[model samples]
Target: MDKALRGKFGKLLARYRVTKGKGFRLADHDPADTAGLDYSKAEARELLARGTALLAEEQSKLYAQDQWSVLLLLQAMDAAGKDGTIKHVMSGVNPQGCDVFSFKAPHAEELDHDFLWRHVRRLPARGHIGIHNRSWYEEVLVVRVHKEILARQKLPDAVRGKRLFDRRLEDIAAFERYLANQGTAIVKVFLHISRKEQKKRFLERIDHPEKNWKFSSRDVAERGYWEDYMQAYETAIRATAAPHAPWYVVPADNKWFTRLVVAGALLATMGSLDLAFPTLPAEEKAKLAEARAKLVAEKD
Candidate 1:
């Protein structure tokens, strides 16, 4: 993308970003808000294609340079299209340079350590991209909404009180800052979808034989806590959003637009880093030239 388009894309994504002190309120953003986009469906697809191509190039450069890492955190209510967003936006990236981790219920071994321990161990090394379907923020989000779960984590009394959620948010901010300082760029996204939209998706899953396996009793039970989840999301995002690790509250009722916004946000973030493929060493260049000369001279 050209400079003008890049700037435009950045500004568009910024509309949904929750930076420090901005304070995210889910109610303020409509899950179906496509007013910021003037493009048609086809145009949105084109934009996503351009972004996917740019992301591929950037990922290659990132791998070659081995100087930086990226972490993409996608958090959402059920049926908000997190899986589809990941599948479409990252389709062009080399699998070798990417790692996708889905954090579900904590395994026994995982619970043995700090909340961030499992995720910390799974962070991408330099020159790689790590995508978390659900992340450590779940500790504050789900656990905060369901206080019983938090109590069961066996955390110290220091973090168990009326201000417990605030303390966890503080810890999250500190953790992200540390990651940023250590050469990781964080792009956190909350796929914001309306209750009605979620209901529609759930109905589809129930009615379609192919999608029947996607629905479960838990999903229905969780639907009852929609307001609680939104509140938790607002609290966590407001407390943790930072310059280096910003949160984007994406309107996800429209899957196509969500992909475009996500792809655009990633392009802008990586482009801002000014990534470039490393130049070969003088000796390596010489060896390559010699090898080329030998191949040219041989009968083909």
Candidate 2:
């Protein structure tokens, strides 16, 4: 049988539960699920490279038309290959039109506003792509995992319990809905790497001189809270997955496979958008033909 088409970004986004006609197939996506795809490592790499080019092409059209935006939100535990995925899958895009942000510990100003405040400032400009290495979802992940961090939100007494957390979910839904209504394509991917895999990757960072800079004591502390973090991810994925903005739990046990999956999912999403380059007017087409004729006349 021919390889199945993953279809377009609009289709996949519509598959999210919150979309008007969305169904259940989009939810409960298994990280290990490969959708019966069969290709060698070489083939997968080539496909990934092609996917990047295709994404860039569509993005270029979107940019020229000044039509839409894509905000790719990557969430994962440390060593889950978020950086690797971004570097490889987005490599073909023009850097000028793409922006990446790493959301770290918040400052005083960030604390003063709502959890999504900092992210609003970093939204992608029209016709550009924004890649968030770690997004506002940390409010759900880190804060939910560590209640002490929740104190920073300064919730009211009655809303201080799980209700407060549910409210954040509602806020996220509203925020994403607003983005979709404003023509933003939201892609949230979770790199699911096992504890053993994370440990191995962490060891590599420690043993390699060049990679040593990536090692931190904080990673150890974070791993210690593995169970809590897993629960946090499960809860966040279950709650925030809307049809307008869906989450894909990409398996990160194999870095190359993870990169391929990220690229494949990206191509699937961008393709779903049904984008195209704007057509030129008749006078402009004639002007371009005349210019090309002049260029050919002057050719060496």
Candidate 3:
């Protein structure tokens, strides 16, 4: 990305980035907000293409450097565009250097371990990027909204009190801090879609034959607890938001804007790492020169 675009994205990111969640209110963020950008859908798509190209370039450097890794946590309500955002924003990235994990309800084995165990096992290796469609935060968000899900975890009575969510948030923050200390950059995004928009999308899924497979009765059931989920999200964001693991409350009503912000957030995160291709040592450089001479000497 050019410096001008980078600057524009930086400013846009600043508007939504929450490093400290004190006094943060989800209601304060307008789901329809586009940061006042009047770009048409085509214009936004072109800009996203540029951003993804730059992201691919940056990912190559990150892989060659083989030092730091990136973990992106995307959390949102049903039909909030998390899947589309990942598909579009990461379109240009090298698949070998990136991994995407979509976390649904826990299975029997997953329930046997602590909340973070399953997620920890799926973490990215060094010099790679891991995208979690819905991550461990679900332990706080979904589990909090639906208390029965927490009961299914079968935790000891001592840890299953009113402060359970708080303890989980603390653990999450500490875990993220540990990852940051170990050369991982964490970017958490909450796709803030309005209830009205969600209803419209749900109806679209019901009406369109191609989208029918995406619809689920469970998704509609969860809609009844919308307010509860919002509160859970707000609390979790407040507790876990930190310098090491910041949250971008991206507006999801507009898919184009959502994709742009997500791309910008990633670009800004990787840009902050100052990633670059590794420099060859003097010995390796000499060996490469010899290999090149041997190859040039051969008649092809």
Best by lDDT: 3
Better of 1 and 3 by TM-score: 3
**Per-residue lDDT for 188-249 in model 1, tens only?**
99999999999999999999999999899799899888888988898888888888899998
| Tens-place lDDT digits, model 3, residues 34-141 | 999999988999999999999999999999999999999999999999999999999999999999999989999999999999999999999999999999999998
Tens-digit lDDT track of model 2 for 1-300: 012434422233232223221232323544444445566889877766766777788778768867788899998989888888888888899888899999898988888887898999999998898999999888888888887987776656776775777788778978999999999999888887888888998999999999999989899889989988887777777677767887877767777667766766666666667778789999999999999999999959
Clashes of each: 0, 6, 0
Candidate 3 Cα deviation (angstroms), residue 74: 0.5
Cα shift from native, residue 262, model 1 (Å): 0.5
TM-score of each: 0.94, 0.85, 0.98
Model 3 poorest 10 in a row by lDDT: 142-151
Considering every candidate listed, which one attains the maximal TM-score? 3
lDDT of each: 0.88, 0.77, 0.94
| Cα deviation of 41, candidate 3, in Å | 1.8
> What stretches of model 1 exceed 4 Å from their correct place?
none
Task: Report RMSD (Å) for each prediction in the order shown.
Answer: 1.7, 4.2, 0.9
